[model samples]
Every structure is written in structure tokens, then in C-alpha cells.
Target: MFGFILRRLLSGVVLLFVISTLAYMLLYVGGGNIARRILGQQATAETVAQKTTELGLDRPLLVQYIDWLSHAVTGDFGTSWFTGEMVSSGITSRLGVTLSIVIGATVITAIVAVIIGVWAAVRGGWVDKVVQGVSILGFAIPGFLIALGLVTLFALNLKWFKPTGYVPLTESATGWLATVTLPIIALAIGGIAGVAQQVRGSVVDALQRDYVRTLRSRGLSFNRVVFKHVLRNAGGPALAVLAVQFVGLLGGAVIVERIFAIPGLGQVAVTATSQGDIPMVMGLVVAIAAMVVIINLLIDLLQGWLNPKVRLA
Candidate 1:
């Protein structure tokens, strides 16, 4: 298991390096005059040349990449061209706001998924049908549409919550939660439905396994057999999907961020792309790619632990 985990970690590091190198080359070597664009067209050629030298745009590609990588390793994520503020510090400052929403939404979605999944599996009949219908709807409906509908219903029509903007959770936890509540729900709906559908399918399959039948024959209660044994065994595949979903959700916050006007990494990424703030955009891209690779590695290690066959492989 330790060997398997170590191997996955190594692979994750390699993947992150590859992603970062590609981003660097595209932004710097691919005809993107980083400093020139940042300085705007109105700036004189002399000023542009000086600014490029200051920003080290004149440095060789290899030197620039090495410097960028070294700085990234040491936690210096460069400054935002638009705001002229340290990018790393800006991200750190907004970390609380983004994390609150992501973590809260993730937890709520997972809990809801588990409950609905287990209930649907155990109950079957009409309950299962309803769950299936909802999951289908979740898969079909776009997130932006959900956000718009939520704003119209709760904010415009009923006045139950604020329609736009974010409030710091530290300042007022209740207000922060209330303000971001709809966004969280909007984000969570698809996750909950997806997880529930996967869990229900896994549970159904696990319940009919030979080992499960044997456990039942051994006088184990139905609930014990299903909850303890089946849930854990089925978790192997279900967890893999869930991990992917979690990572995807963290990066895919762009749509949700835009609709809700939440200033997060996703929002920063979008703005950076629009203005061609290559460094900021590249930083976010690296962050996202690293996050995804790390999550996948963790999932592999978890699967290896849960299923010994995976460890051997």
C-alpha cells in the first residue's frame, strides 16, 4: 500500500510539472509579449522595452521557466498585471471566502447524496423512481440556469435571500452562509444527484453479491450487512467517482462564481483570461491541474488501501 501510494505521488508530481511547463511555453514563447500587453498599446516603445526588461520578459525562455518554477516552489506566485498586487497574497486573502463556499457545498452535497442514495436503494419502488427522475433532471439542467432560477425565485419573487455578491464568513457567519446559501445549493444539486445515482447503482449490485448472500446466511442483520459491508465495498468505485467530482467541482467553480458574483480563483481565472493576464491565468491553470492530479493520486492510494488487489497491481 505504501509503495502504491508513493508511486501515485511521484506520478502526480510529474504531471504537474508537465502542465506547468506547457502553460509557461504557451504564454511566454508563443508570441505572447507578457509585459507589452500588460503595459497597454498607448505606452511608448522605450517604456515598453524598459518594462519588459524589468519584468524579465527579455530573459531566455529556459531562464524564465526556471525562475517561474523556482518561485512557484517557494510560494511566490507573481503579481497580478491588472491590479499590480502580489497574486499569491491576493489568492491567500480570498482563500477563506472561496474555501467556505467549496467546502460547505461539498459537505452538504455529499451528505445529501449519501442519504438519498441509501434511502433509494433500501426503499426502492416509487422512491427510487423519484430519485432517478431528479438525477436525470440534475444531469440535464445547466448550472447557470439553476442560479438564474434561484435568484428569480428566492431573491426577486420571495425576498428570502440576497441575489448578488458575497459576504465574508468571518464577519458574520450567519449572513455569509445565508448570502452564499443559494449558490451552494445551486452548485450542490448536480453533485448530490450524481453521487446518489452512483451510490444507488453500486449498492444494488453489492447487495446481490455472493459474499453478501453468505453474510446474510450467517445470521447478520440486513441493515448490518448492507450498511457495514456493502457500503464499504461499494465505496471503492463510488469513491473514485466522488473524488473526480470533488476536484472537477473545485475547478469548475467558474460558472457558479460568475452567476453568483463570488470572487474566487475561478473568477480571477476568467478575468485574467479576458485581459490576457497570462501569468495569473497560467498560475490558476497550474493550480487547477495540480489540484486535479493530487486528487486523482489520493483516490488511487485510497482505492489501493480499500481493495488489496489494487495495491498489488
Candidate 2:
């Protein structure tokens, strides 16, 4: 198990390195007149040139990347080009807000998806049809639309949650939950739709397997046969699907965060990309890529634990 985890971590590091390198190269090459944009149109050509040199934009791209990577490995991502805020500090301040929403949504998606999926698979009648219909609708509706609908119903009409703004968990737990609940729901609907279908399919397949029949024939209770044996075999695929949904939730949080006015990496990412703030943009890219790598590694470990055959693979 230790060796399996070590291999997964090493692979994750490689993936992170590749993703960061590609993002850096693309941003550096495509970012046009970053200094001029920062300095404004009124700045003279000579002034812009001086600003560019000061930022080491005059350096070779390879040298610039090496410099950034050297400092990045030490947790020094440099200051934002426009705001002059430390990239690490800025990200640290906002990371929690985004993570809270995405993580909450993922947990809800997994639990609800499993219950609905298992129920549908076991019942196999109107219950299955309803689950399928809801999953389809969930896929058809956009996450932003869901956010708007949730905001209108819960925040505007019902007054259950605030329409916009965030409250830190450290400040008030109830306030924080109120602020994030709608966004989490909006993000989760789509994920639940997708994962529930996967779970339903996997569970149905497990039910049809010869092992399930054998277990029933051995006089095992129905609940025990289904929960202990069937779910164990079916879970591997559903977990894979859930891990993918978690990553999708991270991207979906961008639109949901905007709709709800929660301060998070979504805001930072949009602002930095538009302004050509390389330091901030690169910081975000690396941070998000690292998160994806870590999440994938954890999923791999979990899958290995659930099925020892995965470790061999």
C-alpha cells in the first residue's frame, strides 16, 4: 500500500509539472504588451519599454520560467504585477471560500447520488424512471441557471439565505453556511445527475453478477447481500465517476461564485487573466493544477484501498 501511494504521488508530481509548464509557456507567449496594459495608454513607448525591462520581460522565456520556478518551489510566487499583493497571500485568503463550496457540493453529490442510485436500482420501477428523468434534467440545465433559480427561490423569495456576499466560517458558522448553501446546491445538482447515473448502472450490473446470485442462494439476508457484497463491487466505478465530478465542481464553482458574489479564486482568476497579471494568473494555474493532482492522487489511493486489485493494476 505504501509503495502504491508513493507511485501515485510521484505520477501526480509529474502531471503537475507538465500542466504548470504548459500554462506558463502559453501565458508568457500570448500575453501581449503586459507592461503597457498595466501602465495604461498614456505611458510613452520608452516608459513602457523601461517597465518591461524592470519586470524582466526582456529576459529569454526559458530564463524567466526558470526564475519563476526556482522561487515557486520555495513558496515565493512573487507579487501581483498590478495589485502588488503577494500571490501566495492573495490565494491563501481566498482559497477557503472556493474550496468550501466545491467540497460541500461534492460531499452532497456523493451521498445523495448513492442513495438515489441504490434505491432506483433495487426498486426498478417508477422509482428508477423518476431517477433517470431527474438525472437527464439535471444534465440539461446549466449550473448558472440553477444558481439563478436557487437564488430567486431561496434568497429572494423565501429569504432563507442572503442573495450575495460571504461570511467566513471563523467569524460565524451559521452565517458562512447561509452564504455558501445556495452555491453548493447549484454546483451539486449537475454532479449528482452524472454520478447517480454511473452508480445506478454499476449497481445494476453488480446485481446481475453470478456472485450476487450465489450470495443470495447461500441464505444471506437481502440487505447484507446488497450492502456488503454488491456495493463493494459496484463502488469502484462510482468512485471513479465521483472523483471526476469533484474536478468538474471546481470549474463550476467559478460561475456559481460569480452569481452569489462569493470572494474566491474564480474572481481572482478572471481578473488576473483579463489584466494579464502573469504572476497572479500563473499562481492560480499552478495552485489549481496542484489541487487537481492531489485530488486525483487521493482518489487513486481510495480506489486501491476499496479494491486491492487496483493496487496491482
Strongest candidate by TM-score: 2
Ten contiguous residues minimizing lDDT sum, candidate 1: 27-36
Please report, in order, the local distance difference test score of every candidate based on alpha carbons. 0.81, 0.92
lDDT of 2 by residue, 1-313 (tens): 8889888888888887898899999998898888899999999999999999999999999999999999998999999999999999999999999999999999999999999999999999999999999999998899999999999999999999999999999999999999999999999999999999998999999999999889899999989998998888889999899888988998998888889999999999888988999999889988888888888888888888789999999
Which pairs clash inside model 2?
Answer: none
Per-model TM against the reference: 0.91, 0.98
Per-residue CA lDDT of model 1 for 1-313, tens digit only, reads: 6788788888888888898888878776665666678788888889989988988878888998898899898778788878887877767676566667767777787788888888899899999999999988986788778889999999889999988888886688788877889888887887787888998998988888999989999999999998889988887877777886777578656788888888877678778888877667767777677768876887777777678888888
